[model samples]
Target: EITGLDDKDTVFRTVPSDDYQGRALARTLKEKGYDKVAVAYINNDYGTGLANAFKAEFEAQGGEIAGFAAHEDGKASYRSNLAELSSGGADTLVIFDYGDGTGLTILRQALENGFFEKFVGGDGMKSDAPINELGAENLATFVASSPVGEKSDSLDIFNDAYKAAGGDPDAIFVTTSYDAAFLLALAVEKAGGDKAGVSAALREISNGEGEAILPGEWEKAKKLIAAGTAIDYKGAAGDHNFDAAGDVPGTYALFEVGADGFEVMVEMK
Candidate 1:
């Protein structure tokens, strides 16, 4: 029996990874010619880390970080922070929070204070609940950048496998989580069921070597893996190549809430 071990040297990732997501968002905002940006992130590991990465990248690209704010999760009020952001005179706002409920709260408060502008969000802020909560009218000018799940070739196969496993393939996080599980399982299988071996196998597969078993051109990668090839796995989140910082490179899609719900503005690959 393998007991779960948390080793400092052994890094385990649970999702699409934040570094890529952060960079993608920064790049998209810069490309849109937004010189001044503000960040309001949740006070958590994921939120703070992503915000910092976004700030670093945005500033590096000759962009200005207008303001940075932090909100604790489960807090009821963001009026103070929103007021600060409004006073900052930022044209673009990047929110690194989660769920539609929180988003609605922030949006509602911001709108009430007349802080209307081009609002952007991270993956966690991509949800229909916010639109439903604040009503489409309130969110008309809001946009969010999230990992493109449907755009991933692996997601197509992961959807099939998820259905085969009696799961809902349409649920965004569920399918991606399923893909993560399958990736781990495949790595374990290739490692002969050794946990350490599995980790190594994952690194190998992620580095672009291994039998692409999930979907798309993964099969072609099998030869490379057999030949000890280092390959990057373009996952369900789009372009999940592990970077030197142990972060997976992914892509994001810009979405806006319109009368018809969330509509895709552009794919930031």
Candidate 2:
């Protein structure tokens, strides 16, 4: 908390690390029986983090890294990059990029190159932009990994309540946003106010201690807090038990890119 030079403690993220997500992707590829794979990633922090993580785990899992490519975002063309990377002649590619804009373009261009057999990716490919642009049926063989949490009614409740309130039920990461805000408020209440060093209190409140409170239980939580009881907040994004880094344990799911949306193939805790 005191010595981290990256983002200050003022910054807290609900999402899992790129490395964890990447490792999960690698494991999924192994389970799916991909032995050789190329890599294409966004040449940025997010992409690099996942790239390094996946590469390490993929190799450790006895998979070979055929080739790797880094492409800049907002590019309309990636034929040259894809060509150079696929020179390894891998039948499959571990592509890493947001599934929109340049990311979608890269996928389309990669298919045009026509050497790589299938694409494996992470959350960047979870977006619908690629499917919409390239046609889902054409990209049907794409595999992806995404950080996930255990299934809980809290999610179902949030989905229903969100849709009822005109929110997009399928929207990405909004649940994390909801959970973050709600958790912070709960911490403030538990701390008797937004006092100094409340972030420490924030960690305490969400650390799976005390009375269990699901989302939307503001009054109940207040009562628990008022009675000097500890509380665990099971949020819209499931049980968000923050760890020492203000991070939660990573979980993941393997999914297939589908015509309609991402179809979950398997989940890993």
Candidate 3:
């Protein structure tokens, strides 16, 4: 009946959860010994939630939030907000926004003002498009964290599967969406293709009812499932098993923007 798939049993994750990312970022900045930081975010769920999370975590870590700025959607200019962040006495600036165009606009303004020495971004800015839009020279001091990439050994499997399926394995969304599809398919198959059965199967899978399937082991998982073996799918994004909060413990990598592309700086635990 698809009843169990409601907000309760069903998982709702944005690759890297804003809360986790925020905390991790705070920890990273603290490790780097930053005292004051400014936050600039989009006026949306993605941005606001992440900014709040970062602020809470940073404060808990004995860091101060120097300033906070939110930009409306469709707003092309971020000069005013950047000005505020610049004058906020922050050494580091955190950005929580999506889209290369907006990110470039904000970064350009921030750089022009000479407000921050380091710029950090959430998963929303973990794309090549930003560097492409702003030019690498302008993004030299920018960094980001995201749930995708080859941070884990398990990603090898997902990469092979994606290529076999004629897809680009490096595309963040592609691997995540593929893993979701595989999990759904496995559940359905275990439930004997019955929707009700699938719902029941999800609980079993979530509760450690089988061997964990790491990325690239989907074919092995399919065979095991066919052989009446239970399986737990550790996805390319991270472990697909959702906790009580309906959130999965995902992996994220800190990336530095370079002239050619982005390089992985650190993988968060």
Candidate 4:
């Protein structure tokens, strides 16, 4: 979504692109009745991509972008930036930066100076650092959006098996990473260990058709591959049905800082 990398057949992401995430955030804010907002993003690829995507979607949805600007990372001060953003009289601020770095600093300054009445962030701001450092009480009106794995029997099985293997299923992106590796292995098997055939074989396995293969069903997948039977992998993350460009549509959820940590408030459409 950022660099048009989807055009490369050999390149694919187990994670969804920022395009999906940005649209999700925009739609979520609109659903929550925030018709006007400000945006502050770090001056980098990830930040710029999300910020631009969100701006486009928000404006198209009849929402107003009152303020928009980019700031350098690791800055000692973002007050100027905040002042500019708040100049538009937007009560809500949408941040697209890492919560552990510049995002935390910006949030601190914003809160200290009362730059905005509410705060929202992208997946990068979903880190625990903000809530831990700033205190959950101070963030009652704060929320963040992040990609979430769809719940299914495949996910349940992965959770159970991962627990048995002493792994944390809830760790960020764990399911997606697992699915990446598992899918690669299946592709290799289906391709008869031929590297040149792996890419094509990948799509053949998970194109949203054929017999379903759940997590930890490696043996079954191997047997089916050996017998030339088509198998569709139902990953812990999602079905991972790759489109022509090798990109998969993703799911997202809105989260708020809770006493225990970030808690899901709603699934974003």
Instruction: Please report the candidate that would top TM-score against the real structure.
Output: 4
Question: What lDDT score belongs to each candidate, Candidate 1 first?
Answer: 0.69, 0.78, 0.73, 0.90
- What value does the lDDT take at residue 166 in candidate 3? 91
Per-candidate clashes come to 9, 1, 2, 0
Q: Tens-digit lDDT track for model 3 on 132-220?
A: 76788877778887766444566777777768889766544665676667677777777878876765676565456688877656578
For model 2, give the 10-residue run with minimal summed lDDT: 1-10
Worst 10 residues of 3 by lDDT: 1-10
Which parts of model 1 have CA positions greater than 4 angstroms off? Answer: 1-9, 14-16, 149-153, 158-171, 204-207, 215-235, 238-246
How big is the positional error of residue 23 in model 2, measured in Å on the Cα after superposition?
A: 0.6
TM for every model, in the order presented, reads 0.76, 0.90, 0.85, 0.94
Candidate 4 residue 122 Cα shift, in angstroms, is 0.6
Task: Give RMSD (Å) of candidate 2 vs. truth.
Answer: 2.4
Q: Assess the local accuracy of residue 78 in candidate 3 as a C-alpha lDDT between 0 and 100.
A: 72
In candidate 2 the C-alpha lDDT for residue 217 amounts to 86
When summed lDDT is taken over every stretch of 10 residues in candidate 1, the lowest stretch is 1-10
Q: Give the TM-score of candidate 2.
A: 0.90
